[model samples]
Target: MAAFIIRRLLQSVLVLGFMSLLVFVGVYAIGNPVDILISPQADQADMARAIAALGLDQPLWQQYLIFLKQALSGDLGRSFAYSIPAIQLILERIPATLELALTATGIAVLLGIPLGLWAGLAPDSWPGKLIMTGSILGFSLPTFWVGLMLIMLFAVELGWLPSGGRGPTTELFGIPVSFLSWEGIRHLILPAVNLALFKLALIIRLARAGTREALLQDYVKFARAKGLSEARVVCVHVAKNIMIPIVTVIGLEFGSVIAFAVVTESIFAWPGMGKLLIDSINVLDRPVIVAYLMVIVSLFILINLAVDIIYSLLDPRVRIGEAKT
Candidate 1:
C-alpha cells in the first residue's frame, strides 16, 4: 500500500510538471510580450522599462525557471489587470465555489443512488422506467439551459425566489447569515439542482448497471439460494460489490465539478473561482490565469489519487496486485 501511494505521488508530480509546461507554452504561444509592453504613446525608454519590469528582457529558459521558482514558493505573482496577488484573489473566491460544488455533488449522490438501486432491482417495472427516463433527460439537457428554465419558473414566474446573487441581507438564528434565509435558499435551490442534474444522471446510470451486473454474479445467486433476506442480498451483498465503479465515477465527476463551475457560476452571478478565472482571461491576466489553472490541475490530480486509495480500500484484491476481472 505504501509503495502504491508513493508511486502515485511521484506520478502526480510528473503530471504537474508536464501540465505546467503545457500551460506556459500555450500562454506564450498566444502572443509576444512586446505587444503588452508597447502602447501607442510609449517611447523607447518607456518600452525598455516595461520590458525590464516584466522580465521580458530575459531568455525564455531563465523566465521559465523564475516562474517555476515563484510558483513553487506559493507566490503566484500579481494579476496584470487587477494588480492584486493572484493566489490571494483565488483564495478569497474559493469558498463559494467549493460550497456550490459540494452541495451539488451531495444532492446528486443522495438522489441518484436510491433511484438507481430501485431501477436496477426492478429492471422492467414502471419505477425503473421513470428513473431511466429522468436520467436520460438529465444527461441530454445542458446545465446552463436547465438553470435558465429553473430561474424562469421558480424565480420569475412564481416569484418565490430571487433570480440571482448569494442571499438576502439579514440575520438567522442570531447568526449573521443570508443564505440560510428562505429567500436565499430559494435562490440557491435552482442553481444547485441544475449543477447536480448531469452528475445525478451519471451516478444513476453507473449504479444501475453495476447493480445489475452484481445481481447476476454467482455470489449473489449463492446468497439468494442460501435463503438470505432479499434486502440483505441486495444491500450488503450486491451494493458493496457495485461500489468500486461507482466510486470511480463519483471521484471523476467531483473533480470535473470544480473546474466546470464557470458557466453555472456566471449564470447565477455566484462569486467563485470560475468567475474570477473568466474575468482574468478576459483581461489577459497571466498570474490569475496561471493560479486558477494550477488550482484546478492540483485538485484533479488529488481527486484521482483519492479514488485510487478508495479502490484499494473497497476491494482488498486491488491492494494485493490481483487483476480486476
Candidate 2:
C-alpha cells in the first residue's frame, strides 16, 4: 500500500509539471493581459514601464523558469486584478464551492442509487421505465437552462426561495456553510439541484448497469440457495459488488463538478470558485487563471489517486494485479 501510494504521488508530480507548462504557455498565448490593463492614453514609455514591472519584457523561457521556481516555493504569484496571492483568493472561495459540490454529489448518490437499484431489478417494469425516462431528461437538459427555469419557478413564481446568492450562512468549524441555516438552505436548493442533475442521471445509469451485472453472478444465486433474506442478498452481496464501478464514476465526476461549475455559478450568482474564475477570465487575470488551472489539475490527479487506492481496498484482485506488476 505504501509503495502504491508513493508511485501514485510521483505520477501526480509528473502530471502537474506537464500541466503547469501547458497552462503557463497557453495563458500567455490567449492574449497579453497588460494590453487590457494599460490605459489607451499611455505612450511607449508607459507601456515599457508596465511591461518591465510585470516581467513581460523578459524572454518566455526565462519567465517560465521564474514561474516554476515560485510555484515550487508555494507562491503562485499575485493576482493582477486583486493584488493578492492568487492561491489565497482561490482558497477564500473554496468553502462555497466545496459546500455546493458535496451537497450536489450527496443528493445525486442518495436519490440515484435506490432508483437505479429498483430499475435494475426489474428493467422491464413500468416503474423501471419511468426512472430511465426521467434520467434521460436529467442527462439531456442543459445546466444553465435548468438553473434559469428553477429560478423562474421557485424564486420568481412560487416565491419560496431566493433567486441567487449564498444566503445567510453560519460558521461551522470556521467555514461558512449553508446547511447549518434554514435561510442558507433555501438559497442552496436550486443551484445544488441544478448542479446535481447530470451527475444524478449518470449515477442512475451506472448503478443500474452494475446492479444488473451483479445480480447475475454466482454468489447472488448461492446466497439465495443458502436461504439468506432477499434484502441481505441484494444489499450485502449484490450492492457491495456493484459499488466498485459506481465509486470510480462518482470519484471522477466529483472533480469535474467542481472544475466545470462556471455556468451554474454564473446563472445563480453563487459566489464560488466558478464565479471567481469567470470574472478572472473576462479581464485576463493570468495569476488567478494559472492558479485555478493548477489547483484544478492537482485536484483531478489526487481524486483519481484516491479512487485507485479505494479500488485496491475494495477488490483483492486490484492489489494482486498491482503486486504482480
Candidate 3:
C-alpha cells in the first residue's frame, strides 16, 4: 500500500507539472490581459507603467520562471481583476463548491440507486418504465435550461425557494456553509438539484445495468436456490456486488461535478469556485485562471488517487494485479 501510494504521488507530481505548463501557455495565448486592462485613453507612459507593474515587460520565459519560483513557496500570484492572491481567493470559495458538489452527488446516489435497482429488477414494469423515462430527461436536458426551469417553477411562480445566492450560512468548523441552516437549505435546493440531474441520470443508468448484470450471475441463482429471503438475495448478493463499481464511478464523477459546475453556478448565481473561475476567464485574469486550473487539476489527481486506493482495498484483485506489475 505504501509503495503504491508513493508511486502514485510521484506520478501526480509529473502530471501536475505538465498540466500547469499547458494551462499557462494556453492562458497566455488568449491575448494579453493588458489589452483589456489598459484604458483606451491611456498614454504610452501609462501603458508602459501598467505593463511593467504586471511584469509583462519581461520575456515570457522569464515570467514563467518567476511564476514557477513563486509557486514553489505557495504563491500563485495575485488576481489582476481582484487584486487578491489567486490561491487565497480560490481557498475562500472552496467550501461553497465542495458543499454544492457533494450535495449534488449525494442526491444522485440516494435517489438514483433505488430507482435503478427497481428498474433492473423489473425492467418491464410500469413504475420502472416511469423511472427510466425520467432518467432519460435527466440525461437529455441541458443544465442551464434545467436550472432556469427550476428557478422559474420553484422561485418565480411558486416562490417557495430563493432563485439564487447562497443565502444565510452558519459556520461549521470555521467555514460558513449553507447546509447547516434551514433557509440556506431552501436556497441550496434548486441549484443542487439542477447540478445533480445529469449525475443522477448517469447513476440510475449505471446502477440499473450493474444490477441486471449481477442478478444474472451464478451466486444470485445459488442464493435463490438456498431459499434466502428475496431482500437478502437482492440486497446482499446483487446490490452489494454492484456497489463497488457504482461507488468507484461516483467517486470519479464527483471531480467532474466540480469541473462542469460553472454553468449551474452562473445560472443560479451561486458563489463557488466555478463561478469565480468564470469571472476570472471573462477578464482574462491570468493568475486567477492559472491558479484555478492548477487547483482543479490537483483536485482531479487527488480524487483519482483516492479512488484507486479505495478500489484496491475493496477489491483484492486490484492490489494483486499491481503487485504483479
State each model's CA lDDT, in order: 0.83, 0.92, 0.91
For 1-325, candidate 3 gives per-residue lDDT tens digits of 7777788899998998888889888998998898898889999999999999999999888988899999989999999988999999999999999999999999999999999999999999999899899999999999999999999998999999999999999999899899988999998999999999999999999989999999899999999999999999987788877787887898889999998899999999999999999888888899999999999999999998888877777666767236463
How well does candidate 1 match the true structure in TM-score terms? 0.89
Ordered list by lDDT, greatest first: 2, 3, 1
Candidate 2, backbone clash total: 0
Residue-pair clashes, model 1? 0
- TM-score per candidate, in order? 0.89, 0.97, 0.97
Off by over 4 Å in 1: 32-48, 168-184, 320-325
Model 1 residue 179 lDDT? 55
What TM-score would candidate 3 get against the native?
Answer: 0.97
Candidate 1: tens digits of C-alpha lDDT, residues 83-133: 688998998787678767888999999998888999999989999999999
Cα deviation at 87, candidate 1, in Å, is: 1.2
